[model samples]
Target chain A: MRLLHAVWTDMRFQWKHGFYLVYVLVTIIYLIILSFLPNDILSVGLPLVVFSDPSVLGLFFVGGIIMLEKMQGVLSVLVVSPLRTIEYILSKVVSLAFVSVLAAFAITGFSSYGSVSWLLLFLSTVLTSGIFTLCGIMITAGCNTVNQYIIKTVPYMLLFVLPCFSLTGFPYSDLFTVIPSVAALRLMLGAYMGIPLYEAISLVIYLTGMNYLFMRWAIRVFENKIIYQN
Target chain B: MLQIIHLKNDLRQILRDPIMAILMVVPLLLIIAFKLMVLYLVPFIQALIEFDILPYLYYVFVFVVIMCASMLGIVTGFMMIDDRDGKISELMSVTPLGRNGYLINRLLFSSVLSVFYSILGYYVLNVVELPFVTILFVSLLSSNYSIIIGLLIFTFADDKVKGLAFAKAINSLTLFAFTDLLALKWLTVLSWFFPPYWITLVVQTPHTLLVYGLALLVNFGWLFLLIRHYRKK
Candidate 1:
């Protein structure tokens, strides 16, 4: 369908814009840094590293992409095109989520050497990137420039990223898991340090629910602020 | 008069955006956060993990200030790209200000901001106490880094999106500031060519006139090279 085509086009656009090159360089740097860590630290560090960098890169990247499109007047054309708003949002999320998952896998695969659960890592990265990318789309919709988009993301990043400290054996971490970032980090940590089946299932379901809510919100924002220019 | 008008316009552009206003202060916030982390979190981590990070605090602080400078550099870079996209720079080239005047105005603005941020970051962090002269000179050397970064982004990226990517790549090179920490003999030699390494070297050994001279030389070398390349573009 058109959604798949949009995603493919978005991916090509991202590649042409050098997002993939940045990811490759960043992944290689993460690999180098992780390789230098001691084994004991590496185990604890791998998930934290992956959780912070690759999973949330979309939050930083989507703003630049949207702002650039707006500055170039591409959004005006898209407004009249047959491309649905949901497809536009999903294209960005899916394309960026693709990079995030690849980066997570490459980082975890080489650093952990197949000792971690692939399925959990995949699910964690997919949902985490999806949620953050949607959050990005929602934030960028109201902003005019990349600088505004970046600075506006600060409080939201603090909201999402700071709670993730609970993953480091903080007390009452289970209570924090309801927050999507915490849940995503828990899943990322779980990928390395095996969680109970029920915990994994619950975290996955919670994150999926959060992604749906975020996507709905993002579509509304894009339709109003970006599509309609209201 | 022209520079004043340009400055007024730039100030208006930044001040009008509430988010841009916040961006200006994020570095100060980062410094406060670093201060708090050292005061509270470091000890907590040391107690919990028994891994003390106090010894490496100097290098960490150096990296933070350099990072602050780079953030300004990237912001100025985006502004320049915005000007290009809007045809403002093109329009300015035909004015009495000239293209070179516009470029210097931007470079000077970021340099001045970087200098201010560097000095303020040092005072706020309050680690590695040094003489006022040392801090002033180090901040001066670090300012060129912002100029270099700004010109590099302007010369390299034709649009803001690519500028973001280029900014990440260029900022990663700031990692060279820690070449001494890595303690790799080969990297140490390689990092000598990087301006950040020399700025850090001056910080670690502030008394050496030779180090200060070399830092100035390396930083200005890069600044000169970037300006030439930018002019060519």
Candidate 2:
């Protein structure tokens, strides 16, 4: 119940701060660009757009949320509350993942309405957003200001974003599947192009495991940096 | 004397955080990365796909310029938000550094850094053969654009969270330069409203006095409007 309330409050907070509006504007822009593309090009471009923008939206938004809470001293209050650190982290991941899912669906639907594998797309967006949100939480944990968080976020984003080059047939690209973002992109691509069911299932399982590990890491970092002040 | 102290404090603040130091070097790194991509990757892709991308290569330089300027603007904008949150802005408004002084210190800081970075980015990119005066004029105008960005974020966002979102929106305005590349005549006109668009305009036509005048007018016009709104807030 408390976790639900936290998620609700976060949604409200994000809405009040115009995150949803930003997403809407960004989605419109994506749709407009996608509309202009020929089908042959969009067959490849749609997944890339979904993977880059909506799927990683959490990575961009979570820093602002965490920095705001930190600056406002909300974390200090929540620390003393009965809210477990894990629950706080879960609220953020879930609320942000909710937004990312909506955006991914909207963009995918608009670009290739009937052809997409909805199931694979949903799982990919959710898991990818969760992974990036955790990464955002981990990076923002030690930072005091938004500027610090923004700067620190670059290398981490590069860590994830760079691996996607493997999708472009960069040499030795198969090795990139070890990274969760690469897995997520592969799954997203699976939604566009039919992958073997077993491969799809395995990627889903792999991403879920990655999410759990990232969540654990996020919790540890939050507890240490924000809660314990270490 | 007091301004020097402010400058020192700003320097110390940036130095205290290793991330800021990295940010200082990021533009140079970006320039090198862009140069590398243009030099190696573009040709490699051309060879592989048999497509020519040479005609659109100028967009890379524009991206570097806007990116360098925007990063500085974001840094200074967040600094202002931090000051607002810490109540430092309020205190400074009453001190020897009045509100304008407080605002000037930050905007000037970002603008100056932007000038340095823009000039450096131009030399580092070094593909298009621009005259020295043109580079200086464009860099000066970019500093003005950076000031407008800083002031916009500081004025519109009451808190850091909002500031971050607002900063993202402001940075997206750089896309107008890409929009200018589009052949749609109406759309290109719309791009003129954006300050960074003028940077692209001036660059594309380096000898155009009208573009230089309009770029200055538009950038400073936005700066003036934003300053008024900021002071009102």
Can you write out model 1's per-residue Cα lDDT over B105-181, one digit (the tens) per residue?
A: 88787788888988987887877877789899878876888888888889989787788889877866886788676
lDDT per residue, candidate 1, A147-199, as tens digits?
Answer: 77878888899999888777667567768888999999989888988999999
Worst 10 residues of 1 chain A by lDDT: A165-174
Candidate 1 TM-score, C-alpha based? 0.94
- True C-alpha contacts between chains kept, each model in order: 0.59, 0.59
**Candidate 2 versus the native: TM-score?**
0.94
Candidate 2 per-residue lDDT over residues A126-202, each given as its tens digit: 99999999999998887887878888888898888888888878678888998999999999999988799999999
Q: Which stretches of candidate 1 lie over 4 Å from their true place?
A: A112-114, A169-171, B48-52
DockQ of candidate 2 against the true complex: 0.64
True contacts kept of 1: 0.59
In terms of DockQ, the best-performing candidate is 2
DockQ comparisons of all candidates to the true complex? 0.62, 0.64
Given candidate 1, what's the lDDT at residue A48? 89
